[model samples]
Target: MLILSRLRAYLRAVYCRQSFFPGPLGVFVNPFYLARSALQEAMRDSAETLNGRLLDVGCGTKPYRNLFHVSEYVGLDIDSPPARARGVADVFYAGKAFPFDPASFDAVLCNQVLEHVFNPDEFLAEIERVLKPGGKLLLTVPFAWDEHEQPWDYARYSSFGLKALLEKQGFRILNHRKLRADVSVLFQLANAYLYKLTERWPFSARLLFNATVMALFTLMGLLGARFLPDNPDLYLDHVLLAEKSA
Candidate 1:
């Protein structure tokens, strides 16, 4: 039992490190490899511009912490049993207001979190309040993806809808991108479905089945990209870099 637990931990560490910008092993094992790879690239490109006191909102495991060269890094999450199990928060909040002064942070990262917030307006408002004037907000939200995190998942935003939400909170959009569009999205969805279907199987059987499916789908996605007409409208996620108005 102890050995199995250690193995799970080691595998999780490897997945966290390489699942986003996957190599061969990651590509096969990670069901969401295509979308994650795109998100990671976008984040890495944007991370170059961020510095100083930074806050990571809904920072589950702080997977991208090493990407940024910041003076101070603080992680915040809702106080919940799942969060406690993940050991995800440096400071947990009550979901009303953040435990920080206005304009306390130079940058904020809210990756893959907005969809889970029931009151996005209040959430964004708090983020805007905490950010220093001209401070950056690096956010990523799913546009076309499955409902996850069970009943906590509340919303998915289109590109325009996301832009409006940020602008409504007095944020100026600096960079906006759609990740894993068109054929890649199709492949990703198929892979996700297959992953779900194999969930009840034994660990080794599930891994082998999903890995084979991922590899095949990845190849098909690549080929389709080369031959098919591009469609940016159908995408998996939205990546944005916005700034608080001065």
Candidate 2:
């Protein structure tokens, strides 16, 4: 049953381009999709309940609507996106800052987008301004990883750094947890290089590579979590929650 579920998951991963592992098969197994889902799940674990006007910054394809609650949902991105982002977002800003009054939103959920911001401080300030007093801010950023989106990958956050940054911008820290980086996290990353092997072999061979690497990594993590005591570095998702004063 376990193997069957994993096989199903892998097939879904491949068909969906959701991940390098098989499902979430993005433009060559993008990491953000899986990371985003993991982040959202973490947010829920931390008592996150979205309400009021919401801003999802750098919202590429705006993937969090399923979990978002709102008086409004506004998405902002750096590029001119493929879709017009109609009624869902109410409006789509061409760049980072939302064109709205201060204290306008009750919740701001920014997942996997902070590393891309050239100025995280300015971005947080914008979030502060837009969030109503005592509103919520949920964010996710990688702590350990590679240089991705080259010209963009500006910063990563340790629990302390993320907390300090948020506090400096007037947000009080409510919950901050470092993402545990297991072997699976590393394996997912390794498949990135695996794609290059496809030039030497068939696509099925590449998928085979993906399956093998992901399986190995997943096993390592499961075993590590079970045996390794008090290891902080293994958690692969950083979940942060801060609040504006009311």
Query: Highest TM-score among the candidates is held by which one?
Result: 1
lDDT of candidate model 1 versus the reference = 0.87
lDDT tens readout by residue for model 1, 151-246:
989998988888889999999999888887768889988888887887788766766775686778977886787788778899888889999999
**TM-scores vs. true structure, each candidate:** 0.92, 0.75
lDDT of 1 at 129: 98
Off by over 4 Å in 1: 1-17
What lDDT score goes with residue 227 in model 2? 60
Give the Å error, residue 86, model 1.
Answer: 2.8
Q: What is the Cα-based lDDT of residue 240 in candidate 1?
A: 91
Give the clash total for candidate 2. 22
Alpha-carbon local distance difference test for all models: 0.87, 0.65
Q: In candidate 2, what are the lDDT values of residues 19-117, reduced to their tens digit?
A: 312232332333233344455557557434677778787666665565565677877655444535333344557556778788888888887788777
